[model samples]
Target: MARFRSICNTLEVLFFLIFSAWSLGNRGSEAKDTLLAGEKLRDGENLVSAHKLFEVKFINLENSQNRYLAILYLFGYDGRAVWIANRDNPLMDSSGVLSINRKGNLVLTSGKGNSTIINSEEPAMGGNTSATILDSGNLILRDGERILWQSSDYLSDYTLYLQNDTTLGTETTREKGRQLLDFGHSAKRKLWLQITVLVLIIMSAFLIAFIICRLKSRYCDSGGNNEKNEENDTASSRLQLNKFSDIEAAYKNNNASEQKLCGNKDSELPLFSFSSIESATNNFSTTNKLGEGGFGPVYKGKLVGGQEIAVKRLSKMSRQGLEQFKNEFTLICKLQHRNLVRLLGCCIEGDELILIYEYMPNKGLDSFLFDPMKRALLDWRTRVSIIEGIAQGLLYLHKYSRLKIIHRDLKTSNVLLDCDMNPKISDFGTARVFGQNESQANTSRIIGTFGYMSPEYAMDGLFSEKSDVFSFGVMMLEIVSGRKNNGFYQTDSDLNLLGYAWDLRNQEKILELMDSTLVDSCSTNEFEFIRYVHVGFLCVQQSAADRPTMSEVVSMLSNETTSLPSPKQPAFTIGKSNIGVESSLSTGQESVNDVTISVMNGR
Candidate 1:
């Protein structure tokens, strides 16, 4: 008896310690918090987590406004949010408080003494409810044994980013009152009309039912059974049909439309909801804003399934109108080359037109090439590779793609970097497509970056394949020498990067113009790099006819046997042009506006 009493006492103490630890964890005192910038809720108080990694509090969300509660994580990392004593009634101010009641049932009461039951083991005298977060990321509330509401069944824009293998399953179609029927056939030598008229009546009924369903389907919306009739539903459906008809009519009206922009009506396109994008971006928080441009502000967003995407939201106030936007959207969808930026998809929701793209982690080339410390990462080998990559991409866009495209705007800021340090030419807002037979085209409105723009295009709006070549040449020089073509040499000389390169090439001191970051890594291959510089100078010639074709440029870069011709002095007297034109196109246009973006924690 004495030995048994000692063993029982030891067991009781162990149970007590376990209960104590669990109680402490339930209070949410131990979990670490990453208080991000822009999550300003209260003055000092914010979300608190349980050390057990089970619960997160600060209960205010899109629907849970001005409410706070203690929740449990039934699974490892999932938050139950089971105990919201104030469900129907919420506090107007921050006066609402939640605490463990005397019975260990978490309770919440309003300042007006109105308490709403969140979860209870037993149903109220007249009502029934029980709430729990399941391991599959499903928050469920039950009335008796049957579920009254569940998070798994009802989907919203935002979802908790809990760490779990919980996956959204494939969606199934819902039908109204449809059942299977078995067919019976009777074989008799004599004409066997069923003696029982009831069975014949049932067969006739099925035929009538099938005919009615077929009739209903003919008039119904063609986008499956997703159609629901509301006040504006009819008008919206008409508009969609009208849009489709217009596309068809456009093809019929313009015989050349097939060759024109945005002609591929058969291409499979991705469709995403506006609400989904808004939720993914946390309603476009200021933190996720990446960069801004003339077209719109670009934002960083993560999808619910953890796919990172960049969204470009076009501003309504911008000089470019809907037509320009359409042209850009159309050109990008059809133009696919290894060197060109890939267009993943686009979203057109009301006035909110957004283009979704594969997120480039390293951002634009300007970010690193211009930064003092970051530039160190771009060694000679990397720089050389980048130059080669850009060249390859341009070659594809110029010669390999279905249509010959002239990228009117090919500046350092538009060159995007992939994960492997590969370069991709992006931003097709100013691109123009030309046929193989068509040589030159002129536009009254001259639109291009000032420093990168060829002299002929800048003055008389004469642009062809050569305009992009000029920009590429200027960019090559900028890459070789860590200096902006337009901004460098502002003091005594009006000479730009082209003029400087011309002078250096003439004096045979071209090696001095190389970026210092390349000096150590390029110790052995300096000669090859010098030859590339000489090639770059040759491409940026004064006349369009004098400039080498992209194909010729590639051949010169690859062939060691091909002797390169000496380049003439480039035209550098652009300061005398209209000062207003220079200021408007150079400073005003290049300086894109800023935008605010949202970043959700634990994405």
Candidate 2:
């Protein structure tokens, strides 16, 4: 009896300690350094580094109620945000949540289902994944023990940084919801509130059903079928039957005509209604149409908020419509650059596939560069600036961007000019992302403007950064001489732009090729004009190995003193101007921008 009493006392003490630890954990004192797969980091929860110097959590930037997942300084009261995950996309309200999906992808999803950001790379071990914050100030996404990705790689150009702890608790989330519910001017807030209430009610229903299941397992073991039990079981089954049959879910699927937009689950694109866009584009009226391109008609629009936007509507009859739309939307949405055109959002209602972009007041470069009267406006200084800007933008795409991309269909029309004549690269439907070590990729479908395509890409479908450089070279020549390369009919030596430029460079009379409009103004400094012509030749070299990388191109263009390598004889494959031109031309379209679909060569 004495020994048993002693054992009982020890057991009680052990139980007391365990209970205290659990209580402390519940009170937010649990210092967890890792989040396992299938688990979640709630709006206010945090993951701290092992050394506690760095922490990551969703913080409301400046208490603006716009929450972002950011790295924060753990030990300091003074706030500092060094790196942000969703900087481009902030959680609108408290409904934002971060979790590891079943596929082991890191996902940040907002409450109202508006925006969903997913980081999907290598597959985690069947959801047996983990996210850890290390002393090295790295947030690692892991699959079991395998390291899938690291935040350090994403922010290599940036130094380590963080902010003060500002995690939202459950109560805080509720309070945020309440504030938005009562204070928000938009009806969307009320809908968000409804979503929150529905979530809570769903959870409650799940708990009740679980309890009922447990009771049935225990009480119905003897196969007893009493009246009350039968009625209860019948009612429980009925509830289960009705659980998935919500009116909203049914309506969502049935509303085909409304086409209430929802961005693809993987993409972080915003949904825009068909009606709103119709209003913005003035009912897609003929007068509002900006111009037609290979994709479709582009319309200038003004949103209800007084923001101007350019809308690209894909042709309904185009064969490559869906694939091109997905490619442009998914790829361009991820890339951000001053030289890159920004996609505001897209509207996909029924048969209409439309993309909205930040409106460029001056329209495409071709509008000014090729026109005899407008060409006078582009002085030597402006042309040089445009060339440098294009080079820098291509450099970003090739080296600086998170993914190395090749802009396959690069030309004058795809380059839009802003209010200040700043060039922004657009029309990325044919752009392809390359692996870190990949030098080039092959495609059976030769889809790009004919004259601008490099010989290698034009003949063999081999494309890389060099192919874009080749295109840039052709455009540079056109900008200087005010000539169009598409079906370029030359009476002199039967040479295309590349061949003609090559011939001029060999004779050292590049000044002859300069635009006639700028002859008197630019004659004082034939040196600058000749140097640009020299750089253009280097870019259009026959071999991809001969063409300088965009970074080197920028350096050469910037520093006139930099000695340039003599360019080799280019391929000059357009033996007859119309030979390859016809093969690359879109069906039933003579003008470059008229066709809404690219000619595809079957594999």
Candidate 3:
């Protein structure tokens, strides 16, 4: 009888293993909870939380060609995005693919090779990592019991941010709402507007070109008559022409841009030849292109000595100007920190301008943090380290740098990751400096990514060091939840992330807002995590006067037992919705940008 039982047990175990393998292999992309290395979750492939509470899948934005990976309610056509893998840089088409690369990072790559790194701010867990969608609706990347990254940190147990009344300057909500209109702007009227805009652009282009030619005629031959002087003059003239052409070509038709680049290139940094860069990047082949941005394309290259580098190349007609380029180059060159991206060298020849840096194997932070499969790999401790690293980098920029600078654009995409998962702040295009006595400043032209913009800066164009604090607060919430503020919307309220957090705080259910995945996985101080949320709330208070400085934030985060202050209401909360929806299973489609709530003025 004992021999018969043993044989039966062995047969059962083998059958179970065989069945599990078959289920996984044939399951395709549906109803999957875990993903091992070398597996893929292609576009339209999705999964639901164990209790059927939430769903994760790829979706195209309403009325827009771009695609995004979204997390929504289980078994529902009622579309809402809790987290997006590629928010700032949405995929151009629907050929989205979610997979674990050899580095063990979760990546969303298009069929055309455009890839978004989802959980990259953390170190890669190698091939041993497995991505799992948890019962708590948290996507975690883990290596056995060791957590490497998780999506919960991006929006930890949170809803998407409510976007209602985003105004351009003092424009009323109705006026500002016009920009959010994806359709209904009469086709004929739009066509007429397009033609009118085209005419204006052409006329403006002619005027600018004519003015540039006059300036070239004036500066190209200013002095000297002898043969040697003439030769020297010609060479100098060529160099000047090259500078002008590169700067002008690099920027849109902006005044005094070429002069800014010429003036800012003070010879402190090495200038590599275009040929060397061309060789390094295989002549900027399409395959060599790593990514694209508002400025231009970035390419991965290897120097002759075998040093891997990333080159930021400016398109001939890029909208980024010489001033922005010079600011980033000069600022980064002058600043040095482990928390900041290193600048190796640069190239400016003719109509081509390129900035080179040490290659980062991990890529951008958003790649990993927002990816469902890879987020669990971050764990809690690694995430805290990243938060501190970002704060330190910001501290360096705000206080320690030679010039007190404000990083106007501080978002997940701008924070890069090294091979070891260290956080480095990059992209200083919109950074502004201040004198020792200067405390605050304002600009008519507001520049920043949508989701991370501070209340004051986004609304009134007023920015100080505190402006960065507000952005940090929003980012802190995102890190805690793994969600994007711009995409978070509620049919019930205009509360956005801040308002919802305020409610949670008021209700003393703040823990409910934390990444439920971390509730059990994190072995570190639970108080510390809660305290970070408190600090975030304090930072994002409605009034800038109520927010703490970065120094205070650092201190608070570092010392858990420090005394804390109660947070006030957050800015831009219009109110909640009174209307009711039928059900989550309702088959009717809703626009992603549909606005049902009201608005307010002051931040």
TM-score of each: 0.55, 0.60, 0.53
Q: Quickly count the clashes in candidate 1.
A: 6
Model 2 TM-score is 0.60
- Candidate 3 lDDT, tens digit per residue, 170-255? 34543444543333346535744665576566556556665665565456456423445545665766655545543433322111
Q: Candidate 3: worst 10 consecutive residues by lDDT?
A: 252-261
Relative to the unseen true structure, what is the C-alpha lDDT of residue 212 in candidate 2, on a scale of 0 to 100? 69
Each prediction's RMSD over C-alphas, in Å, is 28.9, 19.5, 29.0
Candidate 1 residue lDDT tens string, 1-603: 222222333344334433443353255544333222123223124333323322334465346456654333433224434333344555666655443233323344455564534343544232333344332223444432333444333311122211111442212111110110011112211213432353456446555665665565555656555345422564665554443333323222221222111222112235467898887777888899997777778889999899888888778676463334555566676454455666666666555667788788998998888888888899887887888888888887776554578888788888998888788899887788886567788876666666787767776678898888888888888887778776666355556677777777778888888888888888898887887887777767889898888888888878867898888767553342436435444432334421110111110
Show model 1 residue runs off by greater than 4 Å: 1-267, 573-603
lDDT of 3 at 46: 78
TM-score of 1: 0.55
**What are the per-residue Cα lDDT tens digits for candidate 2 across 1-603?**
222222333344334433432342244425787888667787888887644546778887765878889776553324355457887777788777777777777788787674446564676654577777754345777664345677654321011111111432245544554564455335545654665576566556556665666676557665666546656766765553333223212222212111111211112354589999999988999999998755678899999999999998887665455556666766676565688898887875545678899999999899999887999999988998898888888888897664589999889988999999999999888789886568998877777776788878867778999999999988888888888766565676677776777777778777789899888778787898888888888888889999988988899888989999887876663446545544553442333454222655522
- lDDT of model 3 at position 317: 60
Q: Which candidate, 1 or 2, would have the higher lDDT against the true structure? A: 2
The best candidate in terms of lDDT: 2
TM-score winner between candidates 1 and 2: 2
